[model samples]
Target: MKRLISTLMIFAFALALFGECALVFEKYTTDTRIKPITREMIAAQIRIEEKLSEQTTVNTGEPHKSTPSRQDNGAWMLTLVNDKNPLPDAYKPILKSLSNGLQFDRRAIEQLNSMLSDARAQGLSPVVCSA
Candidate 1:
């Protein structure tokens, strides 16, 4: 009987504590006041969306001609060359030697020469340490 009374007292205390917490939460909790959207605001949003759509359509009409992948005998600038995506065994880039005896891909030779020339003109001694 004593055990049953003590268990009931504990349960009642837990219930009272839960009720007190519920009251405190209700007192502190507040409903967020949402400002209703006006018709003018909706119209403005629609106009902005229309302008964005127009700009996107205008920009997308002209398709960009990008360099083809390795399959098309062309090299992609962002080609992934890792263990999983290794270059083909027969793949070789045409190399050109720079004035400093450094070799690089023939396609990049013009840009590399231009950069080196510019650096030299600026009195900056740029050396090609590595390809």
Candidate 2:
């Protein structure tokens, strides 16, 4: 009986501590006029915060992407299976389109286009492909 009573006492203290923590958190987020609060309300808010944190971490891919599974630069990199006989110059417009919305020269595009054309003439997939 004494052991059971002691366990109950500890449980009650733990509940009190949890309630205090909720009150403290609410005090920080709300005005002092919060005269009353329910334990359920505090528990709900804690659950919401935990869910949001989990979602943010999962969506950002920080911990997972940091793993060196494949060779890559910091920025998302793509590999082309085929630049479709895109003359080396062919890629220039795309590259330029990328740079300042294509304000750059078109010769680069022509070179890429020619290179792609030559590669395709060899019966290879010189096409624009992405990883």
Candidate 3:
């Protein structure tokens, strides 16, 4: 009984501090919605971050690892994330960056999804990493 009371007190205290609103994310779909990035996705994203700057590739902090092959065709699909915004950000900056800095191939998006799934199976939830 004492342990139960203590646990209850801890829960109440946490609620008092963070409040119920902090749990708001639990109510929504993570994909195409409000949520944090996953670990596997984080891993994949880290790989992508490396590919962004050619000048810094030699100095990049991460190791060079094999990534999923990008789509050979010119077509690609992507979701540009804006941490500050709820809805998906527009295609201006993202498109321009891709056009100038990287290949707009379909493989990037597919690889991210694949990594995210692997992470989920490895006991990681699909919560956003930077969240």
Candidate 4:
């Protein structure tokens, strides 16, 4: 009888240990779903963040140079135009007509003409292929 009681006590202890482990495992398990990420998604997210950062203003004690509201008086030179910084809808650059019947930004016309003249003088036969 004594030996039988000892055997039953050991079985009960083993069962309790196994039950506790099962409870612990279940408690730690997660049911949340994880989605896979792609390179294009990361690139697009980065581009969006960069554009948002460009539009946001930083608070500095000193006065900061503000972006020009209009692209006038050669202000376009200092303006940044890229994937992150886009041209304003109201911006209309000054246009000038070239001798070759081409229109370009007035600010750049002088430099473009100078370069063409120099190339011609050097006998390079420079041609305006595309604007």
Global lDDT of each candidate: 0.82, 0.62, 0.57, 0.81
The C-alpha stretches of model 4 lying farther than 4 A from their native spots are 1-75
Error of 3 at 19 (Å): 58
lDDT score, candidate 3, position 13: 93
| Candidate 1 residue lDDT tens string, 25-53 | 87667535655699999999999999998
RMSD of 2: 21.3
**Backbone steric clashes in candidate 3, count:** 5
TM-score, one value per model: 0.40, 0.24, 0.19, 0.41
lDDT of 3 by residue, 57-96 (tens): 5755886554445443654344323443233235342321
lDDT of 2: 0.62
Q: Residues 89-113, candidate 2, lDDT per residue (tens digit)? A: 3433323542224333343566666
> 10 in model 1: Cα distance from truth in Å?
66
Off by over 4 Å in 2: 32-131
Clash numbers, per candidate: 0, 31, 5, 0
Candidate 3: give the clashing pairs.
36-127, 36-128, 37-127, 37-128, 37-129
- Which stretches of candidate 3 lie above 4 Å from their native place? 1-107, 129-131
lDDT of 3: 0.57
The order of the candidates by lDDT, greatest first, is: 1, 4, 2, 3
Model 4, range 1-131, lDDT digits (tens) per residue?
A: 99999999999999999999999887667535644689989999999999999789676778755564545576657877764566877978888888787788988899999999999999898878665
